[model samples]
Target: MTALSELNDDVVRSMSIGAVFSDFDGKINCLDFHRTADLLVTSSDDDSVRFYDIATARLVKTTYHKKHGADRICFTHHPSSIICSSKHNPDSNGEFLRYLSMYDNRCLRYFKGHKERVVSLCMSPVNDGFMSGSLDHTVRMWDLRVNACQGIMHLQGRPTVAYDQQGLVFAASMEGGVIKLFDSRSYDKGPFDTFLVGGDTAEICDIKFSNDGKSMLLTTTNNTVYLLDAYHGEKKCGFSMDTSPTATIEATFTPDGQYVLSGSGDGNLHAWNISDEPNKVGSWDSYIGVVSCLRWAPRRVMFAAAAASVLTFWIPNDAKSEPGAPNPEG
Candidate 1:
């Protein structure tokens, strides 16, 4: 699976279910793969955070938060540490994010400020610095070493944030289809440039930057996913997704950035070949429930999709080891 040749449209088109997990008792809210590890972490409405060894296809650990509940999660460099956003009622208890060491079940710190629950969280590509976007109309930056939020941006609407592959810059998508790019080191100076998302009027649900930093992805509440030229702010293509309001759909770029994939309300996994015109390359419809969360493995030839409580892992069928596969032998 490490071989670069495995990364291709033909291979992705041939991809199918390789593994499935049914351990979750509630809806899975989000999942993330470790940058250089064989691990995948997920946060759910069940108030639990679970870790799966993607290379081994097994659940390694599960921890619960009975007090606050867990929704969004991201690894903080160390495999044992993570940052989790609370799933508690946003109105009653102003939302605060918790940084914890799962190995010992110890709380390390709590990041407080936002008046509403955080909806998006991303770990910086290069360091302990990270970003969180909330329903409170603000995006805040924090460093793992400190307890205070390092920076905050008062946006006009709900926001989503992402860092480029190099982590030298980050992008924020807010109300009115506005996309703002900032220099990571001196973000307070403000965005260097602002781009709009193909004139769409929907609120952006999430934003992602391609590994090469050449493409930007915008997933809006209106079920439209757009791929834009990161530098020039030109729309390269737009795909109308079939997602449900009950689930927050997330679209991802392949590691090579040549394709985009997402799960839909119809329980189908959809992919588009974006090297050019962005045509639908495939739509596998085997899933039984509304596929809500989806993510592409950072380095492996795999992608995972989740429904209410089941998570399905997919891999190219042509590979030596297919279903529930380990890294294929070259």
Candidate 2:
């Protein structure tokens, strides 16, 4: 099916959990999709990583890291290799990230730098460069070719980092609602522009750029998500979710960048239209618990949400096929 078929408000509203995977024993901490493949990867508190073939709608493989444990995982440029944080395991020394080859179940390399647990991790859309934001109040940059950190930025409060669609720039959101934009090549020189969100004054849960790189998305612990102009840093709008004191509900922009969706404290998946004025467009049924993680496929007509031990995929019931389909950033 063409991705545009699923982007319609009615199609989005018609979406419901079409598939459910309950193999996880503990909460799923992170999940990512292969950049140009129909594969999905997820890591959970159960100390396991699972891979799925989204094109076939089947679980492909499962690997365990019982010793070091797995959390905050993402695929490197290569689908067989993944980089993951190992802070949940007591045996692991603090702040060591693992580059693992899941095909053979081997540790490829260890990336060490952060003094505290990493709360956020993302790969650059255009290259091998990746970033990790830590509770240590620092954001570190790395490349797949290097085991050592390439660069790091210190900031106050909890830090979340994200790169624009082109990977030409990266943005960092911190406590006190401060957001700084840095040129990818010379971030060390300091942010070229900074925007103060004014009043959030809380730990940031996530930050993201729209597929077109025209807007920025920020979610905070105070249960608010803000949409902003990427070029001028003007607030386009803000959406309030349920009061979620315990979970970090992530908000993701649709692949077309016309709408945004998030998990809420009430256990439902909520969506809003942010292209002009912000309005609640739809709120799907409860996802069993607070949906701590939600992602839209970067090129597909699908999305997924995880809460507690269940991972559910959403799709329109009558989605029709075309010659090609674009996906979302799951």
Candidate 3:
């Protein structure tokens, strides 16, 4: 059931089971599914953000990004709020970025900081704080409840933000090749520790905490993925794909944490068995371009992947594939 279409040179469209609609026009850069609501929110390149009714497959509302399209967007666990940012505009020195915006219908606020483009964004699970990483070489936390913008903690280079189950923060940098950990409660108290993964150079695009938060999966710009112990910082396993460097945009664990799924620049979603073996799994290649964002839906027993334009819903298969799931080509 892959919706087949050519959105653009930079975008692709593919189909999957639970997805009602897919936009292949590069209108959306990043998207997230609300945990309890039948809604989907997307941040796009056209300086606009949109909300969609998943059940009806229709756009609900659009919020202006104010500049160019946003590079990323995320919904707060609060269920009523959202946070988003755009790519660093070199002319702005990465400061005063129109990046870092939040919305809740009752109120909307834009965070002013980060001299460079804010490439990474996330909300803290244990608290009301939000974190962002930028090309300006810092990670900052914001308290939405208090409306305060906390200043930077030096990660020494551009970093990506990931949080573990215990609420500790991980900041993986572009220059240091290490992952920095900070206790969500330890800010302003003292120094934080960094976890270095040797032998990798390209910028870390994204890092995710495993289901139990015992381990984390790291993705680099060079299309490399590694599983590392969350506590000891020891390496668990490393894997790479034959596709272009783009496919490794994000790596996430299944809702049950029994499987791992990653989106690639080569326009495919690779699902691997976390418990069955290590590398044995399946892949879906219906999108036209890079699969930029991915999220798992446990209640539906499926996951979703978004490229520049389209979105696809994926379901696991047994010997008899499900009705909507196309057989794996790899």
Best by lDDT: 1
Given candidate 3, what's the lDDT at residue 228? 78
lDDT of candidate 1 over 1-330, digit per residue (tens): 535555777888888777778768888888889888989999988999998898777788999998889988999889888999988854444547889998999899888788888988999989889999998889999998898889999998889899999999999988899999999999999999999875688898888899999999888886778889999899888877776867756789998898999766666778998887778888888464767678898888888888888787777776535444644320
Clashes of each: 1, 13, 15
The best candidate by TM-score is: 1
Alpha carbon deviation, residue 218, candidate 1 (Å)? 1.0
Q: How would you order the candidates by TM-score, starting with the best? A: 1, 2, 3
TM-score of each: 0.94, 0.93, 0.78
Please tell me which model should have the higher lDDT, number 1 or number 3.
1
Misplaced by over 4 Å in model 3 are 1-20, 24-27, 35-38, 53-59, 66-68, 87-107, 166-174, 189-193, 243-248, 316-330
Q: What are the lDDT scores of the predictions, listed in order?
A: 0.84, 0.82, 0.62
Residue-level lDDT for 130 in candidate 2: 95
Model 3 TM-score relative to the real fold: 0.78
